[model samples]
Target: MKRIYNTLFIVGFISLFMSSCNDWLDVRPSDEIKEEYLFETGNGYRTALNGIYRKLATFDLYGSNLSWGLIDGWGLVYNLDKAPDDGGGRAMKKIATFSFKHSELTPTTDAMWDAAWNIIANCNNLAQQVENEDTLLFYDRTHERDMIFAEAIALRAYMHFDLLRIYAPSLLMNPGERTFIPYVDKYPSYLSDRQTVSYCLQHIIDDLKKAQSILLSVDKSASFSMESRFIQSYNGESRFLGYRGYRMNYYAVTAELARVYLYAQKADEAYAEAKKVIDVVESKKWFAASTSSSGFNKGNMKMMEDIIFSLYSTDLTDWDQKINHLSDNPADEYNEHYLCLGDELVNEFFGSEKSSDWRLIYQLEGKYYDYYYRTLKYNKQKEGTTYSKVNDEMIPMIRMSEVYYIAAEAIYKTDPALAQKYLSSVKKGRGIKNVDYSQVTSEEEFINMIVSDARREFVGEGQTFFMYKRLKKNLLGMEGYSWKEVEAKEENMVLPLPDSESNI
Candidate 1:
């Protein structure tokens, strides 16, 4: 990944120098060296492909949203936090209200929309450019192009999937009535209309399916590190560019597709997609964590064993932004008062069986001291820091444990015993006692038990809000809010489109 970044820096310098030259007459036609022209060669195509990874690393794109906002932002949908009304936290509050207007969302949301589409546009360009070329022109061109296409297709699908979750209504099982986001198969000459929510999701699924097909053909040996991938200055300042973790490979793509499918509620497809990860985990070859002091940062053991895909920070410092984004937390980064849901809901989820859950208890300090239990998993270190500026954890995008939960869920739909087997697999991985599902008699009882297990397995991992959205239920105190303000509708199951994109 660092090699790719170095190559991109060189490309950027050449482009800058060429642009600065006033005497284009001394050289061949200046346009001959442009992106369009340069990409005509095999190496140029490779560069363009790598450029996709680079683009995803930008702050306005995946670097911020995919791992941060997409996870944290959707946490709002489930009332995970009480988003503050002042400053940066305001937009997230607006999302809770379903009142987002295009003029009100931040530039970040707008930039993210454009960045996502830029990837799609570039991928489309590549697909068009490579169609007529023969396999014999370059080194493993056929294999490379296929892998590139796979990556791009997954990326495009991911972007659209993000949009659908944020904008469209919940997807009903019926294909004919499902809502979707805009679909852009070919680049438009002018603005095009949005597709139905269902259409958009289907297209995303289609793209992912295509990605999975070609990904199966790619080489899998890729290594990554902070030194080479990050743009570090001699004095230690760094521009956070390059692959977030190691370069994304085939396994990551498949895992991501499984997530997309799960959200779409395509149980059968979700199962099949998740099975790919199950196979990997069973082999003990993928998703292991590293054994460093800051293991949560680079060289994470958890990342090696169970993380299917993640974006790495250019440096450990980047975690500061995530920890304190939109808020103020000085010890680490920034902090904010994004409203977490009231205690009633938090406790209800934990239940009276407190002994059975550890995450709910980990925050005993915050709960007993402040009356509100802040997330302990993301707390800042006590090293002379303020309440703001304190992001200091690696946000995981996909974890292998999710695969176990997914398989468990899928298995429950057909065979209870089998579902119990998958659930036990996850428990064993967590070093917990193996649970036997034979003890569960009723279907509803079995589901509730499985969901409880999932809650234990994925606490603060960013899957709660999605489950809330899918179940279409309100947070525990939603009724109280509705009574207190009469008009305070609980928009718990959906996320509004960023007003900026809606207006566009």
Candidate 2:
């Protein structure tokens, strides 16, 4: 909590706000802020918002933990026993087993909550300030002002939805009244618990919708431009107009709304919104170059061409190879750097079409790593190599393919044919010749297909846990717990609120 205040007062917050527009989104300042004049100019507001995005990309936030570290480990994407002794190793194993109360897991979980809430508090501060800002102070005379405000709102909802997904129970599992976490709306919000699952979810959806409405006119990223990946002078519009893929623009907001509706079990609305994204993206012919593992081995490993929203960092190349993908397997299994699957899990994961899956062909071959079989999803462009500037150092938060999956999942029960078409399209994109849908006669089988595809499609992306949690399904256990049945605890989807929040 004190961290949040320290941020608002200064401690790099003010420095980031005062940074030149050219480097606003690039470098985070070491020194802090001058709170009194933080919002005096339009650049101040822009820098303030950029500061929040930078925070979101920190190692404690999406840069590692929430993206592919803690959440993915919990999703059982990696073999729990293979968890390394350092770099969140014990915490990863405990979280995988739902040992939320264990001392090993406390620091990680508490940091997750604190880091997320700190970003949310900063969002609240920006929202509070921007509402009263003079539109004329902005470069585009309300366009930039409105864009920042809308982005702030959408980002707030995005983080809130994530917090709700992590900390609270879903309506599907618990229909009865139950307490939920606080919906901190304003700056310096007194975190309290008076909300319900229904109340918090509705507010999140409402906030997204409000953001979408405002961004409708301000945003031009219906089909995102590749140039949006970089910050350049578009007649002094680079700060706001550029970087749509990283920031929360109109389509990202719409995509997020579809995700929320699906979570709330409103399949029809979810399908409608998802279809909107799919149609626009396809019509625009965006990501047409995305084929054969969607830019694997070509430096677009993160699938940037089709990514709807992502987070960027300059530090990705430093720790990615050594930490996630080690050159050789450790002598002690428990001493491994990160979790990875063995031949057995790999065979089961790929099933009969092992040769067809491009992920196996490109991402996991021994050529990439001399000994260990690891997914090279996060490796970025470095000192050499002729990959495009947009190829590396990006982590996808959501992408067009997932939107297709959402559409397929949402409408499967009512319209299986359309659903299969949607699902098959994605499979086809992954280089599969033909998908046999005859065996998926039942809705359960369809969902199983979805789960299998998601597990395969998002190997190191950390989406598997949320998919499991949303559907209230069991997590696939590893090592001591067999895939079939080693124990009888239902899926540990609910990450308990930290003592700091709970005890308060």
Which candidate has the top score in TM-score? 2
Candidate 2 residue spans exceeding 4 A from truth: 1-31, 221-223, 227-237, 287-289, 292-294, 325-336, 365-372, 381-383, 386-389, 480-491
TM-score per model over all chains: 0.69, 0.88
For candidate 2, write residues 269-326 as lDDT tens digits: 8889899878876787653335565345446555566677887766655446546556
267: Cα error in model 1, Å: 2.0
Candidate 2 TM-score versus the reference: 0.88
| Candidate 2 local lDDT, residue 469 | 77
